[model samples]
Target: MLPSAIVSMTEFPLNSNGKIDRKALPAPEFTMERCDKVAYVAPQSPAHITTCEILASLLGVDKVGLDDNFFVLGGHSILAMKAIMAIKQAIGIDINIVNLFEAQSVRELCVLVDAELLRKQLEETEEFEEEGVF
Candidate 1:
């Protein structure tokens, strides 16, 4: 969705001989749209909140706020690579590193983490059953 707040310059004042004037006018500026309405959004999800807390405390951000954007909070590819390694060591699951950037928001990242966790659990259970260990 395009932001409607941005405005473009219309025209530059012309000099007496129909030449463009550079010094006679003030600096041109783009107008920004102002909106007075505030909208309500749902509360932060449990998993997302948890991830936010972890990322904030570990990555050194302001605080563990779920609404915070990962990149805006100062996360990058190197951090994401480190995150994947940490996640695998902590959760015992292999996850693709690219998912971190694609799933930019904490909520989306939580979903991917949950899915990977469940997949690993199921695989372990299946392995146990295959060995007839119940």
Candidate 2:
């Protein structure tokens, strides 16, 4: 995939009752391919939600805000390390204790989860290619 620049519109270029002025509006910052939202990129995966819910359950808490810090929700050093190990093993992420503190809510962690999944998939693909498996 080639990288391309998609310039942001300076203004909405609207008139009257808040409608877009198509003539003044800039062309899409991205091409149709770039604009197309891939199904894999969406955050509707069971793995992510189940993992977060498992953490919340282990913490014995509710309202598990995606940004809620694990420690603040009754997590201790041991528990944090343990959970990190579990997550790494189960989800292929090297989550650190610091990340938990920095990203308290589950929402913030979703980005990390996506990245880890992508990286793991890449690594597997590379391995397969090297082994001439496909």
Candidate 3:
């Protein structure tokens, strides 16, 4: 796991017994900051837009771009699971958690979801043909 922020201090606060005071350290602030490493790219497709919305809502951000990294947007494992569930509920498709970690972007995730949807459609078509329904 990566730290959200780093705190700089001149000296450590100590207790009466000479032990470092844990409570004296300032709490790390976890805020949503736009990723600077990559330029902002707006979502272009419906699937990309929906995936962006799910990630943005979960991370408490205003907008998510196509190339935004989920972890860099303050998303962790728990939020990743919620994202998976939200995508399944909203898109009617199941995605593995590992895929989210591997993809880490709205564009990548939408591609995975789209592939899964197409695979399901193909399976249904094959089943229908086998059953002589069409």
**Which residue pairs in candidate 3 have backbone atoms (N, alpha carbon, C) closer than 3 angstroms, thus clashing?**
none
Put down candidate 2 lDDT per residue, 71-114, tens digits, no spaces. Answer: 54556767667767777777767766777556655666666777
Which runs of model 2 end up more than 4 angstroms from their true locations? 1-43
The RMSD of every model to the true structure, in order and in angstroms, is: 7.9, 17.3, 1.9
lDDT of each: 0.62, 0.63, 0.86
- Highest lDDT: give the candidate number: 3
Ordered by TM-score, highest first, the candidates read 3, 1, 2
Q: How many residue pairs clash in all the candidates, one count each?
A: 0, 9, 0
Local distance difference test, candidate 3: 0.86
Please provide TM-scores, in order, for all candidate models, with all chains considered together: 0.58, 0.55, 0.88
Best by TM-score: 3
Give candidate 1 misplaced runs (Cα > 4 Å).
1-50
TM-score: model 2 vs. ground truth: 0.55
Model 1, span 11-65: residue lDDT tens: 7678999887867656545331121121212336554455555676666754544
Where's the lowest-lDDT run of ten residues in candidate 1? 32-41
Which has the better TM-score: candidate 1, or candidate 3? 3
Off by over 4 Å in 3: 29-37
